[model samples]
Target chain A: MEKTWNNKAWFMVLPVLVLVAFSAVIPLMTVVNYSVQDTFGNNEFFWAGTDWFLDVLESDRFWDALTRNLIFSAIILAIEIPLGIVIALNMPKKGIGVPICLVLMALPLLIPWNVVGTIWQVFGRVDIGLLGRTLATLGINYNYVQNPLDAWVTLIIMDVWHWTSLVVLLCYAGLVSIPDAYYQAAKIDGASRWSVFRYIQLPKMKRVLLIAFLLRFMDSFMIYTEPFVVTGGGPGNSTTFLSIDLVKMAIGQFDLGPAAALSIIYFLIILLLSWIFYTVMTTSDAQG
Target chain B: MDFSWMAWTLPTALFFLAIALMLVGMGVWEYVSPGGNPRVGVLRFETTRGDRLFVSLLGSAFIHLAWLGLVGANLWWALALSAIYAIGVFRYV
Candidate 1:
């Protein structure tokens, strides 16, 4: 049967489109304006053409920050996806345990971004914080402010704690939606636990997993608040991801042109990556 | 790193106002629907998932506020709160 596509749904989406344009589009255009023009203190702009973009692209600092962003995102995806699935699998399928797991998973997500950073900041302080104090007593020289390795580890740990639950929630939703009949059939066919997960649950969870991956990737890539609060893009710029660098340029140095160009480039990269992910997931859905 | 004074003001004022408003709103709602259970009313306020989610959210927010007051925004506090809230939901709801 041919389904009639409802045009009325567009109205429902119109509000969101307007909100997004206000929040995303105008700021983007402003950035585009800044990227191509040099401005003095009096709000005057002169044509700089692609000078800022070229400067940004050719800089070693930009490359380093980009590399850090890519590596951080890669690490987060690798760790969170499997860990989240395992957590979802172990959660109680029914009865008392269901809400327990869910609320625990949700708590980190609910805390404000700045608060998470502050919490980690204090928690990692060697003098007053628990983790740092314990590590110090054990004779580990573990100051994140001084050591690049410590800074990286602390940042990674903070992100994992903050975001792993999102993945878990998505995977759990996918898991719970599966029909009991599928499991029953697997049992009847004498399918092993691994086989059940591999052939049925994993495939069933593809869409949600894709969503989890995309959300996590985008969020990790754009992460600024927590790390900024914790490290301030210091320890000799070791933990300075692209977002942090952009903020430093725009706010710290007030270099409007290059910062604007960098932001546009950053937005484009995220958009491209997201499109690729959508295409891959949808095409796989068609095949499956 | 020195603790900025701004964090002190923003979170406290915002948290208190939010909680006060919620409680006042609930009080008014209960006064209008005198026969309805307040706890259940609080729980089932939202239609999509019912009052359970509402109650859970309230409880979690309270816990978070209390943590901020006591521990002053430490990472462990966030981690602990997350664990507490997640457990509370599974067990209570």
Candidate 2:
């Protein structure tokens, strides 16, 4: 349906504009200012052109963190999407179990990020945490605090636990919205379960799955809290993603210019990559 | 009555209480208004005011978590992000 010209509708959006101006525009301006100028002591800044940006781009540390971020997001999307789909497929469709399962799934998503981090932190402690104690009892020297591999494993597991529900919920929403007639038609055609899913369910769920994929990608790429809490971006910077590294620079080291440049670069990367992904996927989605 | 185990400050309690009251107020508003006339937003899906509210709350929590982890302990940015998220949800989600 085409919307009629209504200049009055702009009035409805004024509040949003105001909100964005203060919340997004102002902070972004601060970052932009920081990205350009070198800061000394006592509220003094010197013009520093593209020096910070070039420095950040040249830094091996920045590149390493970016690589780590890419790898982590790639792994997360690879695991969570299929796993969530499988779980959503197996979930009860029409019973008391639906609500129970949904609530159980949603519980993790509702927990505060730091709280989730803290929960995993304590839960994986070698001395007091249950998982660590059990692993030790089973003769596995699993120490997340000391082992980079263990720290990565813990971070991945922590993320999966915290976020897989989002994918499941979106997929489930798509699943439940499929009309009963579609199933009946498939049954009349003697379609197998896999065939039904492929022809009917999967196609129907395309939009939501795209949403799931994008949401997961964005969230994982920006993941900071759980890993920061679990490993403090260590086993010696091994678990440090770009966001974690950026925080350490901007906040921990108080390096404003380089941090701001890194942040702008980071944001641009996400924007460019997401734009490409959306266009490619949506074109395929539209055709399929 | 020794309530030391509560683990929350007075301000935090009041904040929560205010939230509860706001939710109650929203409930009453919903009942009075009845049909929400769900409209298509940026998602191209028709969503009610309640759906927007739910989305904003969930998005706000994530924003807060991200801010806590990546930014400083200060909550001003989170509040800003939450406000933006709320507006986005109402306008788009």
Fnat per model, in the order given? 0.00, 0.00
Q: Model 1, A65-143: lDDT tens per residue? A: 9999999999999999999999998888999889888999999999999999999999999999999999999999999
Q: Clashing residue pairs, candidate 2?
A: none
- What's the TM for model 2? 0.75
Q: What's the count of clashing pairs in each model shown?
A: 11, 0
Q: What's the lDDT for residue B65 in model 1?
A: 38
For candidate 1, the docking band is incorrect
The local distance difference test score of each candidate is 0.79, 0.84
Error of 2 at A287 (Å): 1.2
DockQ of all models, two decimals each: 0.01, 0.02
Residue A239, model 1: Cα distance from true site in angstroms: 0.5
lDDT of 1 at A25: 57
Give interface RMSD, every candidate, in order: 20.3, 16.5
Cα lDDT of model 2 by residue, B1-93, tens digit: 653322334444575576678678778877788777478777655567876776676567557545654664577878898998899788776
Assess the local accuracy of residue A207 in candidate 2 as a C-alpha lDDT between 0 and 100.
92
What's the TM-score of candidate 2 when only chain A is evaluated?
0.97
